[model samples]
Target: MPVTAVDTDTDDLTMTLVGDFPAPAGRLWRAFTDPRQLERFWGPPGWPATFTQFDFTVGGRARYEMTSPHGEKSRGAWEFLRIDPENGFEVLDGFVDEEGNLTDELPTMRMTFAFTDTAEGSRLTNTTYFESAEALEQVVAMGAVEGSTMALDQLTAVLSDLRAYAEGKGTRTELISDQHVRITRLIDGPRELVWRAHTEPELMRQWMLGPDGWRMTVCEMDASPGGRYRFAWAPEEGVAGEPFGFDGETLLAERPRRMVTTEHMTDTDYPSTTNDLSLYEEDGATLITTLIEYPDKETRDAVLATGMTDGMEASYARMERVLLG
Candidate 1:
């Protein structure tokens, strides 16, 4: 939300992004300079970046990889061109290989990140210069605008204490796009236990029930890549709704960190959704983010209209109070 405007000029072969933050210039500057803070927002929501080498000197280079939920890696590098403390910096950004060597898979660009003081707080002016209009159009068609905006929006949370930013927020849902929805909750427990609650059959049965009347009748799980899981719930005696279940296969799992799965309604031809689950722990608590990608906009809307968020809230509250506590 901090990103205020974006402008593209084919004639100039450039793209400019403007953002206003409530933090001062020094704070915003640190966020860009610190590798740890940069890792928090360098990529979009589901794809997180990890820096393998960060040399911040004027002539130095930094290498990082943004990893997708499906275990795909996109490597990149930044060669520092200019540096002015608390004011701005310039870097030549381009794709890199796994060995940290620059690659030509995508065109490179020069970028300038400038920070200045303002009455409200600080302003960030980011300008990217492309060698040609063709390169600019190519990057734009590759979702550069949406990805950059979403990445910067995540900086709002990173600018504050993460625990304070997320605690007590309960289960919240954000429609990321026509076919994608993100659900998040801050669990009041360690990452390991939270991961177990989702993977272990006994632990999952204890807290995965959506509502008070529902009881888990079947809970089968395998928390490994290519593994399959099935969960079914039935209403308690005297309750009304019929029994229902979901089955899914784990497409990827990174132990306590991230997992990607395909979920489908049992015994139905409904299109499956890819659920990307990621966990970030800080100060003894874990933040759980699940990005669900549906087949189409209609399917996404239908799933959200089912009061799915409310059910998830109830289930998560029970998890925190009964299982995590």
Candidate 2:
């Protein structure tokens, strides 16, 4: 197990777990920041977690559900209190209802996760501050210590698979749920330039084009919260595909790091998809992850059947070529 110790202090009304990992602090940071990587080990062995919503910013909230082997579920939410990139973060952790609302079923706690370099690798000091000694005892009695230890132990496998999320892996798509799909691409460019390539019209047209025969004909972007944007693509004169476009209104914009938008096909009454896009940089390269929530399984399947990931890979490959140049 990666966890070295689990200590409960009634005097301080807290529970602390210490874990040592072979990966560096940055890798650990990404594991926590990326929902896809995080879900891999956040829950205990039998109860796997799925983050339905992860904003990952100060004041932001993350909602997740850990489903048991027999379909029972435990929902939880984290209200981010402070974030210190690659070092630590503090959150108000609590249980939630099926609709994602906080509930009183379990005691809420303030948890702090601190990361530091160790002789062999990195160490994570995770301390949970309970409201009272009774709360600490309550959690312990519920097996929080054992559950957390097993969860942390699963991180070893996730950290060992470095190449799976490294740069040059090209565009990858994962069906996170029946209605949610996550797409990731590590671009060989800084976060600023990558963000610009996505927001700036001239830069966007240069790489957002999918496949060799098509070109972006319209690239209109507002890029501010609540602002609307539109994009259209047309096949080169001889190419056979029909022209297409998408329009969306930004829901949140956190500058070079995160953006949330509601997207819909232009001129269509189809329900919109909430696209949560996040960027993380490591070793000077930026990884772009977009979690798209479709209306239903049918819509998700229809979109995937349309060769979305293949087109995305082509566009992302083009992005590296143009952005790096």
Candidate 3:
């Protein structure tokens, strides 16, 4: 997890937040500049954001809205004043109405974000200067502190996903057959690294744990065609229900290219499945295709209904962090 520290200096009419992420400055910089990435994490949890306008040049403007769980929308805008690659930028941030008109009643502030390299990773410091101490207090009273903290946390997750995609780990899924689900990802790293991450247990442990709060307690892999492998996952802390896992045997093994395996859950209603993974190189990026065949169409449909794709994509994003590291 990233560390976020927020400070408010009423005398200076400013609010400052400093955080550190285990990623490069360039990666973190994208989270701020890229519209797609910014929309994903610009708001706090339960209030997903959407960016309609993002012009990242000097004097450019951006308009976005964050929707709350209760179906309320809070719109905002930013006028860019400066742009610096891998370093930071300055913007005028303010509130807007549903019609995208700036709200005169709200206090607009000037925000500057600075990014720099650090021993741990990348350090981001944001200073928001208001016109007066009263203006600073106005935003703070509106839960700015908590909201910004949550937004930064979302930014960290976005950074992880972006890094993976940037490294050629972007993924897309399709249903090719009644019983098969195929997932394809472009990996920016070498095919060898992708192969090792899939075949090596130690490396697999770094990214295969389904989602956050889960850990692989058992990771056994035999890369040979006839070899068997088993992976068990449990909650980091004890949960209300029993832990679950899967085991399989390699059906085909082609180093740095392809592998076929059979997988079955240990304690679940889901049926067994077969996974065929093929890797190729295109323009120096590794293209990985994972085809999963379930026992039946019903089984495949059931898994998909459980939002399995989101979990798989999230896991792969975590894998990108491991590869980058």
Using lDDT, give the best candidate's number: 1
Global lDDT of model 2: 0.84
Q: For model 2, name the residue pairs that clash.
A: none
Worst 10 residues of 3 by lDDT: 161-170
Best-fitting candidate, measured by TM-score?
Answer: 1
TM-score of each: 0.94, 0.60, 0.52
Q: Give candidates' CA RMSD values in order.
A: 1.7, 10.1, 15.1
lDDT of 1 by residue, 1-325 (tens): 7999999999999999999998899999999999988998899877888888899999999999998867789999999999999999999999988887887768899999999999998999999999998899999999999999999988877777768888988899988889889898999899999999889998888888998999999999998999999999999999889898999999888888888999999989999999999887888989898999999999999989988999999999999988977
The better-scoring model by lDDT among 2 and 3 is 2
Residue-level lDDT for 80 in candidate 2: 97
Better of 1 and 3 by lDDT: 1
Q: 35 in model 3: Cα distance from truth in Å?
A: 0.6
Off by over 4 Å in 1: none
lDDT of 3 by residue, 222-308 (tens): 988788988888887754435778887887775876677888887665667878776755446676667787878888888789767
lDDT for 3 in candidate 2 is 94
